[model samples]
Target: MTCTIFYSTEMPNEQAKVTGGIPTKPMRWAVDYVVKTPDGRTVVQGEKTIQRATFEELRAVMNHTIGEIGDEVGNEATFVSWRATAHGGKKKNRKGGKRK
Candidate 1:
């Protein structure tokens, strides 16, 4: 159970203080990458913290990283809310559903 958390803030004033001194300003969303499967393809977790300026940028990074594993193995990718996982499961992926 390996999980990587990414935080981004869209506010011009608020910045993400991640590892090292490198700070990401204008943060908006955060992505929690859950790599539980050996085959990879974990998640594209996006939330309020992901900044508007960096949303697509972050998404692109996630897509390149683990998207292939899930797309190839499960043939499905989704945008899931961590808040909903506790109850049941509410996930919404891209329209095409898992890139071809």
Candidate 2:
């Protein structure tokens, strides 16, 4: 069935600037998604965690994912919402508290 998907991209750690030097590690991202119909029926949902060496590469990944989902679900499926947020340097525990 036709549906809309809401998704968000997140960087779990602080990003450093690309100064006049090369980095030794890549950046990671967590992309979470939820697909639901107009009447609130969930069709599909999942998260994809990926690492990239550059911002351009990250955009490429997101675009590819959106394109593939569109192709699979046909024109009726649309990504109506998208956001990019970052997490602080703290990991949460299962109880929703900050981990030490």
For this target, which candidate reaches the highest lDDT against the unseen true structure? Answer: 2
**What lDDT score belongs to each candidate, Candidate 1 first?**
0.38, 0.46
Tens-digit per-residue lDDT, 65-97, candidate 2: 766765666635533233222222323366957
Model 2: residue 45 alpha-carbon error in angstroms: 1.8
TM-score of 2: 0.48
TM-score of each: 0.25, 0.48
User: How much is the lDDT of residue 86 in candidate 2?
Assistant: 28
State in Å the error of residue 30, model 1.
5.7
RMSD of 2: 12.4
lDDT for model 1: 0.38
Candidate 1 TM-score, true structure as reference = 0.25
How many clashes in candidate 1? 15
lDDT of 1 by residue, 1-100 (tens): 1122343333244333333222233333445544333344444433333343233465565556455646655745443212101111234574878765
lDDT for residue 24 in candidate 1, whole number 0-100: 38
lDDT, model 1, position 59: 51
Clashes of 2: 0
